[model samples]
Target: MNRPVFMDFERRWAISGLEDLTGHAGEAVLPKRDFLARLDELSGRVEELGERFGVALGLDHSVFMGRAAILGLTRRGQTSCNGTCRLIESGDGWLAVNLARPEDVDLVPAWLCRKGDDPWKAIGKTARRCSTADLIERAAMLGMPVAAIPFSRHPGEGRDPDLSSQTRRLSRLDPGLRQDDGLEGGRRPVVVDLSSLWAGPLCGHLLTRIGCRVIKVESTTRPDGARFGPATFFEELHNGQEFVTVDFATPDRLRDLILSADVVIEGSRPRALRQLGIDRDEVMSQRPSMTWVSITAHGRDDARVGFGDDAAAAAGLLAWDRAGRPVFVGDAIADPIAGLTAAEGAMASLLEGGGHTIDVSLSGAAAWVADAPEIASW
Candidate 1:
């Protein structure tokens, strides 16, 4: 596949630090699809939106692999590039499990129903005896990010049937926020970012770069999970953004912040926000011109929890090794991809006069990129 000279340079620069971190050493693993091209396409969309808003924004594929560079991550074959997630073989199929949080590690014994010193070893031993379906169901119940690796010839060749159904359900939801007049001349958009981790924060960061006033909000009880990660990586996505902490018990301040924003970015399950008395419909009703970006593992209605690694694996976004076995493509790739897609969606909606809820799912975004026409033609 021949690409433009500029694109070739962008791909090489994007994958520079990531070259030795995707497949096993000396195996030369590559993704079934060109994820860099997909990223380039999304970056172009964001750039176009910036132009419409009279902002000069320069984006490239380097954003997708920025985390790997910050963390100095390397590929570990069945293990995720970030070293927090793993692809384990179950009796029926393969599953990706991510123990990204300390609490997630604490729940490993309960997930396996036995105590063990090494979580990965214990998980692998128990997974060999249990069916992938059962393992996934139990992990979902525990709020852990676990996904069954569906079979596919290419990154987006075949998706999990359940994911397709969820996507359809998402499509039928209330279409975008109520339409309003586009952003006023000389007025910068206000963005309330209530999302944690990479995807949502990256969206906020991009918006900030695009001349938006972004406020990063977190609950006092449940702050951003990324705070525990590498400090520099966290700062990269959040620099120059306002920070606020709200008390979940009394989230009136959070509601007020959402109501006062031109764009709202959140990455929580639907029910989680509903339980906190922050309904999307209600909020949008109060502010018809607002654009809400909802990022999730699946659709808004699906209760299944997912992180970047498991969600990408579930979407069949994997690299093939020399032996033809699947290996992870990059470090929580779904997160960055979904983040860029969400930002682009937000920008497009705003350019169209607002009143839109951009429902971006990590797995769904990965599937779209994997199956992008550009990748197929290339």
Candidate 2:
């Protein structure tokens, strides 16, 4: 297998398409012919690999071919398509194209890998089931760039080397801590979920799974992107799940909720709480044992607005163009990473001698996978 050659070409192929849009003038638009040409190139490679995988599994050639073609077309410029799309027409271009006029749209190649089954099950199933080399080989057969697909969250966001090392230090508790340990004794757990989007909700969902009472706070004053953005709200089918809601208005209401919470996990800028009148210090002061967590695109303290896609690209967790265009990670890393980190911090604090505050940055969490060579969670 020409693995190196294949990867080199694939990377160039991916980046070139993204870079093509770098100089797109405010008035210039991607010509349909040019866009289709790139799509054809990506589709051809994908279908060829799909055929090979289909044959290996003794499936009908046409079945896999159809799936591959559909997948390929979707990756191209189609609105209903999935996988990845870099260089989306933004600014005037985005605003110019009327959603009612679908024919005028254009899309760039973005890598998307749809799982055959549940991703979590895939994680556990893949573990001890195949070597990285074997997995990479399979990914190649299926037309996925396994090496390019990021596995870790930002550095130290969750279970990075620092975290692993810390956990190792507590090796005395090796094989001792339970996934559900606080269920006893009327734990009266409180989760202040400030995260939005699927990943954040999933994190809170998981906490609710372990009997944590979760209260989600939002406001029309500063609406969550998911509520305002159509792609964010309805693009994915998982957005329909129910979550407890609270408007971040009225200091007394905020205080009442804060006094009730044991853990607060927020997926917003640092000091955002204070802006909303829910200051961390004030909350902690009110409830000395409270645990506060903040999640963001960049690290919480940085003067950057790290949206999930851009931060994922910057952190190397998602594909990026040679000219620095972004390919959003398949999974929203910030949401899940922050959620998991917040959950872990909550758990740690619950087990701690006292209360404390934690800040989980999406960028830092995204870098955690590759920074440590020996540990292989990726």
Using Cα atoms with residue i matched to residue i, what is each candidate's TM-score against the true structure? 0.87, 0.49
lDDT of each: 0.80, 0.41
Residue 50 local lDDT, model 2: 27
How many residue pairs clash in each candidate at the backbone level? 5, 13
Candidate 1 error regions (>4 Å): 1-18, 152-161, 166-184, 372-378
Q: Per-residue CA lDDT of candidate 2, range 1-378, in tens? A: 445644454344344343222222221122111222322332343233223222121212221122223233222221112232222322111100111112112110111132433332333333334343444344334433122222232333322112221111111112123344344665657776767654455455545555567777665465455554344332331232334446666656666766788877677664666777767776788789887766655554444444433333334443333333333323333344444444444555555522677666655554542132221111
**lDDT (Cα, tens digit) per residue for candidate 1, span 101-147:** 78899999999999999999999899989977789889989999888
lDDT of 1 at 3: 52
